[model samples]
Target: MTTDASQSQAHTSAKHLYQRHQSVLPDWLAVYYADPIELTHGEGRHVWDAEGNKYLDFFGGILTTMTAHALPEVTKAVSEQAGRIIHSSTLYLNRPMVDLAERIAKLSGIPDARVFFTTSGTEANDTALLLATAYRRSNQILAMRNSYHGRSFSAVGITGNKGWSPTSLSPLQTLYVHGGVRTRGPYAELDDTAFIAACVADLEDLLGHVRSPAALIAEPIQGVGGFTAPPDGLYAAFREVLQERGILWIADEVQTGWGRTGDNFWGWQAHGQNGPPDILTFAKGIGNGMSIGGVVARAEIMNCLDSNSISTFGGTQITMAAGLANLTYLLEHDLQGNARRVGGLLIERLRAIAAQLPGVREVRGRGLMIGIELVKPGTDEADPDGAAAVLEAAREEGLLIGKGGGHNTSVLRLAPPLSLTVAEAEEGAAILERALRSTQF
Candidate 1:
């Protein structure tokens, strides 16, 4: 096929931009592909690259685009709010902020819940750490193995993943806990009952040795750790123990919030028997690409701070308007129900394909969030090269995907928009199957 001149020019522009990007940006920013293609625009679940190639977007900008690309409602809300006023700090009364906060408090399921908005998940979690340590008067914290909280210093101290954690210098003392990743840890070989018992016992033992921790922070499903998760009710069991010790529980729902998991609105609901978390941090999907993040907690914990604080950019008018509109559309459409139905079918289709692929060590996830772990044929050793090859091959087939894991980073991550259609799921799976086949031994 002969390419159009305009498309050819676009490709050249992309190359030129990439060179400028590399020269100016940090080296660790990490981009996909050997020859990276700049995405110019998107609509719904598809995006067009610089070379006029349209690809099915499965990652959704790391699951930030929860609803869809270029959603008219959100666009309209943002435009209207921007035209009126963009930045009015938290020093004064913000009606849009109050309205959105009220909606989130009721939906949060925490009794007498209070909300504090932030600009990103990192800030939300950082605020939580501040609340917990101040309330408990201890800098010690408990975190699960193979988990990622955020990028801030306090966030990194609690982050269990070495890949994402950039430094060991931190003000807080962190104790790594078990039960985050069930299949790869020492408790992996045990049955569900035994595994839960073992992890709880380890937690108790760990607590006996250290000072009382301010909180136990964890992600229900390790998002950046390759979509891995412990068995259902694992955190519930941990909660029982922590409750006895007066330790608070913090649920970081950054990637798992807003009905992405299908079965539960928040990822922590899968382990809700112990009651809602003492503090919950959320971002990413809630804003649907707008920069909105926050923490919800009971008034007791949220009001414990004696000193005053405020976020200069948090809970601004425009982002709040976008959140209100996006949340309204999401609830009206019952995207959670759609995620359950469509995700169920998509997982089945991927499982069927994985059965025929030797490199696919495991296919795991819930709802719209799914992952495919790659290995060296029959061996259990991770095959990161195979993952990269499959990623490139899928791009060639006009499909976009992502990669994540613990030690070796060998799992293909898939978290498309929650409103993805069944036809789109089928198409993505077919392209992935071809990509996987190309990586065969």
Candidate 2:
């Protein structure tokens, strides 16, 4: 068949699929692009659409593909484990699960750590909340403003981003705190040290007004909040106050964990003044795309529950095998170092490009997790339309990126695989430059 004819057929197939998807799927479920393309296969840092068009994947399936697409190590582990057994549940003795748990417990940094595996980050965060509330015996919780934990009902209760939080009803009384975003808040104009002080003071004041909170949950680097974060030591400062009042600190590392931040193996390490967080929840990227989520806490906090709880599919043999292999590959290759080196270059390139564009509000992030916030050319108003235009333009330029923010969704997110090469970074940056310029009206 001719290439043109084949492409037309593929496009038609995708259109039909879209129609079916619209008919059956929830209306609130969102998809990118005006005409969405069905991704067929992926390798390294690129994916091919059903229409056979290849593109550099900058978002890495919402930053879940930590290593790379179709990694041989993860693929082999999943295949071999599948041949033996897929799942035996948490009831039976699972060697792979125990092995991965031991490794994560040691690497987690919490003293006498205990790990509880879950199926997704939402579940992991939910587990953390349960532990914290049970341990402290308080339903009140503290969470950062513009932070996103997960999509589950319990997780949504703690989420500060109104866009992601569909319902106001929640099991926990979550108090949203300030100081997550450094660029656009009351503390935006302050220096790093002063900003930390102000946020700490705010926390102290908030605590005075509320009941004793169980825990303070935060994303060291707010992922869905446009990759925004407070000053490095801000959380550490809050820890001092929370510790005084016996409040636990839970770091949501679903998007920022496993060395994605480059400089630190875990995002919480960036604010490691008072040792590790009391509870740490991780998912995304640990299994290198496998469904793996877990919460790591000290033995005392983790053992607070009296009733028995077991995840039937949380630490399944296949997922554990995949997690073990993926973690080994990540460490052996020093992909953290790779992220530091390559992501540095990519951010610099994007920043340089942003310098010439008036609509580009700010480019902020660390390591591979970067965000380009868009705004009106001459004003500070968020340009959600401009962001959408740039996203479509980049897709046309053979690049796949992501969009995120608090409520406006005006920030362009770029988080390529940690194994991304310098050449690929440069190529993606070039495409982004053109895409950004295309929307400069």
Candidate 3:
């Protein structure tokens, strides 16, 4: 077939698939680009569409592909474990599950840590909430403004991001606090020191007005909230107050865990003054695209529940094997260090490009997780349309990226696999520079 003929056929195939998707899927389930591409397979940091078009994948399936696409070790482990058995439920003694849990527990930094696996980040956060409320005997909870934990009913309640939270009704009484996003809130004008003090004072005042809350849940770096984060040590200051009230601190590391932030193994480690959080929830990346979510907490908090609970599919042998292998690759190769080095170069490149664009409001985040906020040129107002145009332009340039924010989805989120090479970073950044230029107001 001629090249043009093949391209036409691919377009038709994608159109047909999109029509079918629209007919069956929920309306709220959004897909990228005006014309969505069906990804058939991926290797390393690149993915091929069903149309045979190749693009550098900078988002890494929302940062779940921690190491790289189709990593050999993980593939082998999953294949071998599947050949033996897929699942035996939590009722059985699952060796892979136990092994991963042991490794995570030791690395969790929580004293006498215990790990419980779930299927997704949402489930992991749900479990943490369960433990917190049960142990503290209070349903009131403290959460940072513009935060996102997960999509479950309980998780939604605690989610401060209006874009993600669908309903106001919740099982727990969640009090939204300040200081999650350092660039947009009332404290935005304050310096790092004053910002921390203002946010801490606000927390103290909020606590005085309400009953003692079960726990204060926050992401070290707000993921779905456009990768925004408070100044380092802000959480540590809050910890001191929460500690005085015997309130537990839960770090939701769904997007910030496993060294994605580069400088620290866990996001909370950036604020290590209070030791570790009482409970920590993680998912995405540990299994390198496999469904593996878990919560790690001190033994006392993990064991507070009186009733027995088991996640039937959470720690299946196959998924656990994948997680173990993926994690092994991540640690053995020091992918975290790679993220620190490569991501540093990438961010600096982005900032230099952004300086030339008036619409680019801010370039922020750490390690591999980064966000570029778009706004109206010479104005502080968010420019969602500008962000959308850049996203489409990047796609046209053979690059795949993501967009996210709290009220307006105007922040471009870039979190490639930790194993991303410097060459790939440069290539993606070059494409992104052109994309940003294309979208200039």
Cα lDDT listed for each candidate = 0.93, 0.94, 0.94
* Local accuracy of candidate 1 as per-residue lDDT tens digits, 338-397: 999999999999999999877888999999999999999988999999999999999999
lDDT of 2: 0.94
Worst lDDT window (10 residues) for model 2? 432-441
Tell me the TM-score of model 1. Answer: 0.98
- Which stretches in model 3 have alpha-carbon errors above 4 Å? none
Clashing pairs in 3: none
Q: Name the 10 consecutive residues with the lowest summed lDDT in model 3.
A: 1-10
TM-score of 2: 0.99
lDDT measured at residue 375 in model 1 versus the true structure, 0 to 100: 94
Q: lDDT tens string, model 3, 1-441?
A: 238788889899999999999999999999999999999999999999977889899999999988999999999999999999999999989899999999999999999999999999999999999999999999999999999999999999999989999999999999999999998878899999999999999999999999899999999999999999999999999999999999999999999999999999999999879899999999999999999999999999999999988888999999999999998999999998998999999999999999999999999989999999999999999989999999999999999999999859999999999999999999999999999987764
**Which scores greater on lDDT, model 1 or model 3?**
3
